[model samples]
Target: MPATDVVSWLATAYLSGMNDELLGDIINDVQHQGDTSEAMYAVAPHLLALSQKSSGKMALLMLIHAGLISASSQSQIAVPCPADLATEFQATNNLGRSMVLAQLAHNHEFDDFKYLIAALAGFSGHGRFGRLIEGFDLYQDQFHHALLDTPIDDER
Candidate 1:
């Protein structure tokens, strides 16, 4: 499918309240085999637009996916992002950063505030940290147990 078509379908499906499983298809179309396709750059601007005009889970997910795609483009094994696409992606990324900051500033309650912070980290060029934050929930119990078992030293 053409990148534009993919964007259109994604928007329609998202607005129509598609399940995340189906939406994962759109994400997979742009990112597969541990790398992003050129289509990701093309779809990024549209994702940014969606994020801007939407709210809640869908918007945050769009921003995080786009930021992850941009970050993956920097990996040594991945194709180098085109200069033009990089410029456009950076503009979108900056806008996403601003949106996240605005949300944080409002002190709004979020069901997944950690994901929002993760998206912010990715937009700020700390993709690894962002990923770690995103994965924290999966390991929350283990982390808590480890912390409880560890002895703290009061003396330097």
Candidate 2:
């Protein structure tokens, strides 16, 4: 199976679970996904650059999925952040974190560009060309995030 396929499967699994704690397990995943020379030497810098404006949690995920940006694997080479990518991912809602995680499941495509685009279509209810996120009303209730562990529940 392709990496994207694996990730799409995993994403379905995660969405089925639908909780905040699920975020943490995935957060750890971002920190340790790649450990190759190709990862270390070629990809680390780009990851770091993408993470510049991200929050700590968001940055970590971008780092893990963008390629590699670990201290042990910091490349002397600089990966240029392109000035002309027509698509600009901004974290207006949940950001692109989930989309990035979805990318990791597939080792086939360099990233989950396809899934990200699809999910984004679902999120905002619009395709990259302009179609809105479909099925928005059907699954809009906390996205089932409410089923997750709560602090009040921990008191029990």
Which stretches of model 2 miss by more than 4 angstroms?
A: 1-34, 63-70, 74-156
Residue range 1-57, candidate 2, lDDT tens digits: 123433443354334532235433433343343222322222333334445544444
Per-residue CA lDDT of model 1 for 35-124, tens digit only, reads 667777766676777777767777777766766665665555666566767788778778878877876765444425666777788778
CA error at residue 146 for candidate 2, angstroms: 33
Superposed by TM-score, candidate 2 places the C-alpha of residue 111 at a distance from the truth, in angstroms, of 26
Model 1 deviation from native, Cα RMSD in Å = 5.0
Model 1, position 2, has a per-residue lDDT of: 63
Backbone clash numbers for all candidates listed: 0, 11
Q: Which runs in model 1 stand beyond 4 Å of their true positions?
A: 1-22, 105-111, 138-140, 144-156
Clashing pairs in 1: none
